[model samples]
Target: MKHYPVGVFCDFDGTISKSDLIASIAYEFAGQAGRDLVRRIQRRELSVREGVEAIFRAIPSARLPEITSYTEQLTVVREGFDQLVSGCIQRGWLFAVVSGGLDIFVHPVVQAYRSEIEVFCNHLDASGEYLSIEWDVTCDDLCDGGCGLCKPTVLRRFKPDNDVQVVIGDGVTDLKAAKEADYVFARDSLLRVCREQGIACTPFESLAEVIPTLEQEVSL
Candidate 1:
């Protein structure tokens, strides 16, 4: 087997968890307004940053603790996540969860592997009466997506020279990262977009299926 360095940048929400926690929490807390914002995001009527900001802005700051608690209880990491993280560490591969999700909930959900893999995401602020987002990362000139955490920027910064850039994701948030990847593991909307754009990719429904495929790629 050939020895090569690999960088795996995976999405958080829908890809890691069984569902999109952002949307789930939005609808649960923000109600119809949250649903509208999410719909606008899907239709490209609003940027992901804009939509997410509006969604959270609807909820009171006091609800943050409750929200965090609910999110932790509700989140379920995808199968093979730990295995994948372990494999990467063992193989000297870089595995990071680069998400458009918030730090509050994202951190709690991935707390088990907090010391293992790197996580890049946005922060949630409850300083005022209503919650707001604090974007610690943003899109560079090369991108126009207005992604809150800017996955592409994270990918570019972390992707090492001569390393295979692999991206795993399942939504619009992953689109720019896919364009930057040498290998892509896609599903759902991201899969459809990949097909439409003619971007070469491997479609996967779960992370379990991704493990063998990724291992084989790096070995080759």
Candidate 2:
């Protein structure tokens, strides 16, 4: 068997969790306004940053805690996430969550793997009555839809020069990041784009399937 140094960067919302927490927050907290903002984003009419900001900003700042709690309670992270994280560590592979989403909700969901998974995402200012992103990691010009933090840039910064880069994601925000990877595992909207663009990829429905595939790729 052949071995390659591996670095895995995964999208947070739909890939790791059964549902997109941002959409949950927007629709649950922001109500009709959130629905509208999400619709625009889905249609590619709004930049991700613009749509995300508008969605959260529509909600009262006081609900930040409520949103966080709700996300944790309602979101179901795919099965085998624990084993996948353990498997990566056992193989000495780097693992990270590179999300185009906010930390307000992501923190609660992914905190369980804080020791093993490095998380890179945007922080939101919920101190006011509405939510707006505070970009700690800025998006690059390659991003046309305003992903506040470009996942590809984050991947480049963390992945070693000699290591093989792998990306797993499920949405439009993941497009640039998935393209930068040497091995791609895509699903949902991201999967559709990868197919259309002729990008080499593996499609999966759950994290349970991802581990074996990664091991297979690393073997040769």
Candidate 3:
């Protein structure tokens, strides 16, 4: 019997890392004006794609490396993250990082478990003076939200092989995906959305709270 065959999809920004790396880059390179746009995005006044595009457009391409490096230097993966990965591995779970942000920073922060996790995130085009976005096609099917790399689509790909669907996230990008999950581990913005939308989710601040649930729920 497959004691643990759950597939897990996690959000990268505030969920895994201590904070939003892209937002840090935005505040630094996009300036105060870009910060305003980010707020608008957070407030749901602007779409995530548009707001992210505008922020990157404001940043000079040359600063991409500096911004990524700075964000990586400060990024602290949540305590128990590696342990969570190990638990998943031992239990036969597939853990994936599905982020709306670019891959440049995602890889570095999760490098220790590089081979363990599958990453589904956007790519950057920094050839010009200003960085440009080349959104990833993580799923061929489009979500109603029109997220370039739809998180639900990523889960769908693994659903066939995996008997259970699990998602952990903390922000706007996670809202829709959470609804589709059989189990949701949420905090911050995602937790709020789950409550408001009537999606049942467990609120957790660290991976430690989540591991036992995974270990106990042998079948979904």
Tens-digit lDDT track of model 1 for 1-220:
2233888889989898877989998889999999999999988899899899999989999999898888888888888777778887787777789988888777877788788677988888999999998886788887876786898888777665426889999997788899999899999999999999999899987676766897776553
lDDT of 3 by residue, 1-220 (tens): 2334788888888988878877888887788988898898889888787788888998889887797778768688897788787777776678888899788878776777778668888888999989998887544545766564688888767777777888999997788788778899999988898899899999888886777976676454
Better of 1 and 3 by TM-score: 1
| Deviating ranges (above 4 Å) for candidate 1 | 1-4, 217-220
Per-candidate TM vs. native?
Answer: 0.93, 0.90, 0.91
TM-score leader: 1
- Cα deviation of 3, candidate 2, in Å: 14
The TM-score measured for candidate 3 stands at: 0.91
Give, for candidate 2, the lowest lDDT window spanning 10 residues: 136-145
Candidate lDDT values, in order: 0.84, 0.79, 0.81
Q: Rank the candidates by TM-score, best first.
A: 1, 3, 2
Those runs of model 2 whose alpha carbons end farther than 4 Å from true positions after fitting are: 1-4, 141-145, 218-220
lDDT of 1 at 135: 87
Worst 10 residues of 3 by lDDT: 137-146
